[model samples]
Each structure stands twice: as C-alpha cells, then as structure tokens.
Target: MRKGILIFTLISFLLLNTPVLAQEPLNNIDLQPFLKLTMNVTLVNTGEYPKFIAVNPTYDFKTFREGDEYLLHNTTDLIQLSKANLILNKRVGFWIYPHEVLKVEFSINIPMDLGELYLQDYADLCYPDYTITWSTKRITYPPSLGVGPLCEVVYPHLINYPILVDLTSFIQVRDPEIVIYSYSGEVEFTITNRGPKTMFAVALPLIPVDAKIYSITPNPDMNYTEYMGKFLPTYLKSQVQNAKFNLTQESVLFEYTDTLLSTMSSQQNLIQNSITTNEDIVDYPIWIVVLGENSSFDIKYKFQWEFTR
Candidate 1:
C-alpha cells in the first residue's frame, strides 16, 4: 500500500511538471521582436512524438540547425553546415522531442540593408498544426555599410546640416552654404544666400551620394515676391508669376538670366557715358545680380526635392 501511494505521488509530480498539450489546435504564435537580424527562439513540444518546424527564409537567408557558441568555436560543425545545401523551402525541423523544449538561434547575412524583417515558422504536427510569426524592429542600427572609420550611412532618414556662410569674396567659399534635410522620403535644401552680389543663377555642385536630382518647388511660406525684389528685379519686369528652376544630375541651376542696361550720349562738346554694375559682387554656387548701385541682399531659399531609389 505504501509503494502504491509513492507511485501515485510520482505520477502526480510528472503531470504537474510537464507542459500540457492543448485540446484545440494551436494555429498561430508571435515571438518577441529583435533589433538585429539574428534571434533565438524557444520551441516547446507537448505532442506525443518529435515534430519538424519549417522556417521560411527571408532576404535570401540561410539556416543552420546549430547554436551560436557551437557554430563559432566548433570548426567541424561550421564546415558541415556550410557544405550542407539544406533545401531552404523544404528544410524541415529543429527537432523538439515529446515534452521537451528546444532553444534554437540563427543569423542571416543579408545582401542589402533592411529596415525591419519578418520571419516565420510553419510547424504542423498533424495533431496540433500551427504557424509562428517573428518580427525585428528598427531599434538599433549596425554599421552594415562597412566597419571602416570613414564609412558613411546615407539612408533617407532624419538628418540635419548646420550651414554658415561668411564670405568677403567667392574665393573664400571653402565650405557649402546649403543644408540638405531628408524626412519621410522628402528631401529639402535650406539655403541662405548672403554676400555682395545680386544672384542671377544659382547652382548646387555636390549633392548627397546616391541621391538623384529632381525638380524642386519653393515652399508656399517662402516670400517669392520679396526674393525677386532683392536679387533679380529684372525677372519682375517679365512678370514673374511663380518660382521656376531647373536641375541637372550633378548640379541645380536657377533658370534666370542676369539683366544689364547702359545709356550713353555724345553731343557737340559735352559727352556722358554711364555703365551700371554693382561693385560688391561675389560669386557663389548661388548667383545674384545687383539691382541697384548700392544694392546688397540676403535671400533665403527653401525648397524640397522629390526622388526615389
């Protein structure tokens, strides 16, 4: 009777410790989101036998049925997995035996940068069929471009460039005066032109790497009337209705011409000749033509660039 009671207690303990299989089918499961491409998953098998879970590959990722530490230190295992051309689509199971839980971790070597990645596991035990979805969040950014010191990240993310221009002459323009800002896939250049010249035609020589030049429109808040009044007053004569400009792959050119007028008269004994051009002229990527003899203007140009990959 004592032996029988001890056996009952043992069975009760086993029942309490082991994970119970759900009566209904487990169709879906969501895993924790990770920042990096690699993640570790713990799969529990409460079924009667060993089952296979097929992982769907994303971004041409390869799978190896090995743990992180073992894959690194164990050269034999690494070579074996490397040579093993496991059919990605048909690659079945990181085996979990009955009443057992297995922890499997894997890494993906992606060809290009990824913002967020979604991974899945299709596990069908026939008895309890299920699918598990895992996602990675863009919480952190690794230096995927390169590990070198000079490596730059130029994705269409939130970025700002502080611009300062103080030039007595064009030769003193050693740095750029325009600041490029990209937010929510829209690119904008916040430009402030200040110096001793009436800007006629402005050009941006260098742009962000891998960014294509496209048509840009002035922001509505920007005072176009005031802009033309200070710099190209000649454009007003032509009845400038709207802001117009052109761009090239390498440079952004302002589609406006410089206007100059001169009047001279030679009569009998007295002769008078006058040529009007501002002396306070400085050349910059942003061009300006002086409107008056003592003309000096500070203009701000804010425009947006629309582009794709």
Candidate 2:
C-alpha cells in the first residue's frame, strides 16, 4: 500500500508540471480587426485547402456583390443603427482544435468593377480553442478581458439626427392669413414633457438652427414677451420680422406639457404649473417653417395666428 501511495504522489507531481498548451492562451474576444467579409465572388480552390473559416461552418460568398462595394453593418438582422449608437454585436467565426491547422483553398474572381472595400468584425474568446490567423499576421486578440473591441464606421456620408417624432396636426392660420386674409384664428398649443427629467427649458427654442433677423412685431404666437413666459434674448419671435395679434397679458398661460397630450406622463406637472398663473403665464411659441423641395422656396418661421388685423 505504501508503494502504491508513493507512485500516485509522483504521478500527481508530473501532471502538475505538464504544459497545458504549446504556447499561450489568447484572451481577446472581439473580432473587428480580423473580420474580412466579401460580397459577390466566384470560388477557386488554391490547392487542397487554401483558406478555412475556423468555426467549421459552411458559408457561401457567391451571393455577394462580385465587383461592387458592399456596406457592412454589425447586426445579424442586417439593419442600420443610429449614429449615436456605436457598439455592435459579434459577427465573426473561427475554427477550433488546439493544435491542428486546417486550410481551405479557393480562387476568387477579383474584377475591378467592385467599388471600395470595407469589413466589420468581432472575436469569440468564450472558448480558448477558436483561432484565426492571416498571412500578414498584423491583427491580434488582446490578452485581457476589459480591452475595447475598438469600433469603426465606414460608408458614404448621409443623414443625421434621424428620429421618428411621431404624427401631429396643427391648424394653419386660425385668425386669418396675415398676408392674405382679414382674420386669423387661434391655434392653442399645449406642449407636454414626457421625459422623467425636467424638459430643459431653453431660450427661444431647442431648435435645429437659429434665425438671424428673428421676430419683429408681437402677433399671436409672435408675442415674445407675452407668449414665451421667459424674457430670453434668444427668442426668435423677439427679433421677428412681427405678425398682427393685439397683445394681452392675461391671454397667455404657462403649461409644462401640451393641452391634449396623447403619449406623455407629465400632464400633472404642467397642470400644476398652470395654477400659479400670475407671472409665468407667458410661454414660448411653437415656431415652424415650411418650405418646398426647391432650394429657392425658403421662408422664416411662421407662428400660430389668433387675430389682430
């Protein structure tokens, strides 16, 4: 029994000293740099196996754009994400086997008809068995967990601030067409703040751009000092080029939200704000400008009209 115990101890020591891997463990799990994707191509085998997509999965590159540049997005759904959001899910594959090297050989028809080329990637370090190596050997997986999966954007320039603000209706020129009619009607506005955070109150507006000449005369919505509760210099109506509404101090009111808010929760806050109406009754106008597709058809903001002429 003593001899058997001694043999067991010796074997345990040898096992502990045994090398687990031939080299080192690669820890980086992101796949952006090593990710090479191709669209539109014909297959040609190099010799036996010139290239092998390591994860042991079969993929067809034949359906890709043969010579044209194809844009790559990081989603499996293949849809675009907002410019504000940059992170993408993993979209890379690798082969397994700790020591065996497999290769897939194929000939590709590289025609000049293709435009620019770009690629997006991610690595899977969940299992240490997966590995991908290229001839240049420039790309690598970092040996740490917290290392960034360095994201990149590549494509033609396009839209900005893309968001779906939903459908809303406005009654155009209630009193009268200031330029054409004798009377205009009032378009009562009640803006609702659906956000948990206090909807940031800005100067005249939280608009995409500011007006140069701005407001001139105080009409219906253009009454900068009256409609807009705060006397901010940046108020667009204050500089207005003005409308024709006879101003009244008591006619204005302060509302935190819209009058008939459909999809917001701040109805109570705005209702409360309306109660103490002596000083802050005045609120900013909902200024908007409509233009035709033609660049020549541009106009300054048109405020809601009540009546004055």
lDDT of 2 by residue, 1-309 (tens): 432333344333222332122322211221111111121112222233322221111221111222321122333235332222122234322221233322222111111110111111122334234344433534445466453555322211111111111001111112221111111111111122211211111122111111011221122233233423332224332342222443354333333222321111234232211111122223343322221221111112212111124
Candidate that scores best on lDDT: 1
Off by over 4 Å in 2: 1-232, 235-252, 256-269, 272-281, 294-309
Which of the numbered candidates is closest to the native, going by highest TM-score?
A: 1
Cα error, residue 277 of model 2, in Å, equals 14
What's the distance in Å from true for residue 22, model 1? 46
The CA lDDT of each predicted structure is: 0.27, 0.22
TM-score of every prediction relative to native: 0.20, 0.14
| Candidate 1: tens digits of C-alpha lDDT, residues 83-196 | 233333557323445766555554332211111111122222232222222233223333353344543321111011111111111111122321112211122222221222
Q: What TM-score would you give candidate 1 relative to the actual structure?
A: 0.20
